[model samples]
Target: MLVSNKLLVDNDCPMCKAYGACFTRFNLVDNNTISPYQKTNEAFVNDIDLDRAKNEIALHDTQTHQTLYGLDALIKITTHKSQLFKAIAEFMYPFLFRLYKLISFNRKVIYPSANTAVGRDCTPDFNLKYRLVYIILVALFTGVVLHEYSVSIYSFFGWESSWFLEIVVCVGQIIWQYVAVKAFRKKNNEALEYLGNMSTVSLIGGLLLSPVLIIQSFVVLPVLVLVGYFFVVVSLMLLEHIRRCKLKKFPTLLSASWVLYRMGVLVFILTIFI
Candidate 1:
């Protein structure tokens, strides 16, 4: 009972975006017609009567009243071109399905689902490359910003300091951050992933530090230091709690602790001479 070939897709998923092109290339559609599930009314979209569409790449056969999602839909779309591909797809489905579920899980975290029970197995998509690079860049950017604040404040107070050594120490701290994480977490499983995760959490926590530090230098506000410390602590605590609950044997706890100490140093001005 195959109905007319109208491939409805969750426009929100990057995987579906790729699959949509497959539909066009195979002449499955005469026009570009992938409906973003968020806007699409699911009542007309066959077997997925509820809105599980948001968490999965849904493809429905209106005639058969059958629906496929994630790896199933991908296999369906590719199976027609070659039996070999279908076989390969079948072989890969177990792993791909899990990966797909993981991506779906992260996506739902950002744009929740009407059906929360879906994608229960998907873990956090650490997004190692992008997150690692972002964390590195942010640290360097924050370093420069803090350097300027240091020079200004120290100069105003008639003190002398070697900024070159300070810069070297700051960069060293970032590098050792990775080492610390591996040291603290006993398992050493997914060390790079843990490092990336910790860096991501730390960066988010201190995102406001650079600007606030610069501002405080001019304004002489007493509470700004505490505010910065609060930001970093909230981020650290959030990550620590997440690790304890989700990744019990995870690495990077030591590195994260060191990062907390470094962030504290940033707020030390308010700590002393009070």
Candidate 2:
């Protein structure tokens, strides 16, 4: 179900570029037509509302010269593959549209966009509601994963893991980072953005550990194996933190503070709990 459509995606956003590639890869649209709005010609760009396209993706119909935005564009492209999906999409439009907005609003914060000097920068407007929703959702997810992982290792420490404690710690990390950023950087506006990036790192670390948590549910794995895997995930997270910090142009001390917070937590756990 190939459509004669061109998707103008935010080139600076990796996720947007990836999906654009996917549409072509899966034959939902033509390979050559998936153009970056940043690099798209001025004449072609005039086909759609530029402001709306920045907030939501723009899909241009080559033949009809019609443009659709956000979930409408995606549903149109994807539903072409199957009638069942089309029916489901039609039924679930409201929920799916909200979900799409959530992701679209937070996409830049999820992965900060690269510098775009050549053309239109398709950065979505910062909506505090969406930002907080993103942060709270990731915090909850990370907290739950931490609570489960902590319980798995509780036998070694002779302590029980509390969901409340883990959730508090999850929140505390955000607060701690926010305080540190404010204290050092002194930029109130950038703090939220920095916290968003930090939360993303936490989310990635939690996601990495989720498989081990799942495996533990089925089999009784050794404590050393669990700890080893956790260390590996932490190491990967460290690399990610460094990469993100570089992307954000944040100081090395912020990364240092990140490590310091975990180390402090480790010390607190070993001394008091164990």
Candidate 3:
């Protein structure tokens, strides 16, 4: 159609600010042409609702006299020039829309770290698919570790061992933690974030055991094991506290339950190899 229009974006929005650059990077749209919504957004915000215009990507086509919002707006602008991006956007639109809503819904919890004065980096991604991919990878890595440790033990008794139980335990921890959180106090919208955070912190704790396990190969280091356990426990508590504070929830029962389950998992696995 070759219809001409400038993309209007909320300057205050972190996503809007970031996407402005993305348009240029994709080479589908020029950065200069994508105008801040503050100037012209007011023109059509009443039609689309001011909040909608600010929260989602909004485009005002001066030539066609039309306005587009949300993921559609992004697709229209970026995919116009590239069939590859267009196809990709179609494939991931549903997931990306959900991810955008997650971030939009939980701006308070995720944005504070990016303090302008302190220059702390922002953590903006809450893409559910990305989180799923991450957790699975972590779980798989942990599975490999558990399998190796289990096989080593079986060699002494000349008995074969399967990682089935160990793999289940490794993956079960993440699911159990989510169930605990949902059971105590459900934050339906934050479920993905909850799972993602749990997986991330658990993976970190699991990695800490890697070093301790390596040391245990030569000499039994009880002190190191205790220290590793302490670090992992403290880390989980700290993360839960921050998560609660950010989500404006005061329920610690779920947090405590999650911690207990993780600690239990660690102990159970330790007994298997030790």
For each candidate in turn, the TM-score is 0.41, 0.93, 0.49
Q: Indicate the residue-level lDDT of 39 in model 3.
A: 60
| Highest lDDT scorer | 2
Task: List model 2 lDDT by residue over 1-274, tens digit each.
Answer: 5556778898888899898888788878877678888787676667888889989998888778899999998998889879999999999999998889889988877887557647777888877887788889999999999888878688676787789888887898888888888876776657777888888888899999898888888998988898888899999988988888888787768888888888988887777675
The per-prediction CA RMSD against the true structure, in angstroms, equals 12.3, 1.8, 8.4
Off by over 4 Å in 2: none
- Relative to the true structure, candidate 2 has a C-alpha RMSD (angstroms) of 1.8
- Tens digit of lDDT per residue, candidate 1, span 143-204? 56555555544655565544564555456665675566656554443555554445444444
Q: How accurate locally, in lDDT, is each candidate?
A: 0.54, 0.84, 0.61
Q: Which candidate is the best by TM-score?
A: 2
Range of the 10 consecutive residues with the lowest summed lDDT in candidate 2: 112-121
For candidate 3, write residues 128-163 as lDDT tens digits: 555566667777877766565545455554656667
Which structure is stronger by TM-score: 1 or 3? 3
Q: What's the C-alpha lDDT at position 198 in model 1? A: 51
* Candidate 3, position 211, lDDT: 70
Which residue pairs collide in model 3, if any? none
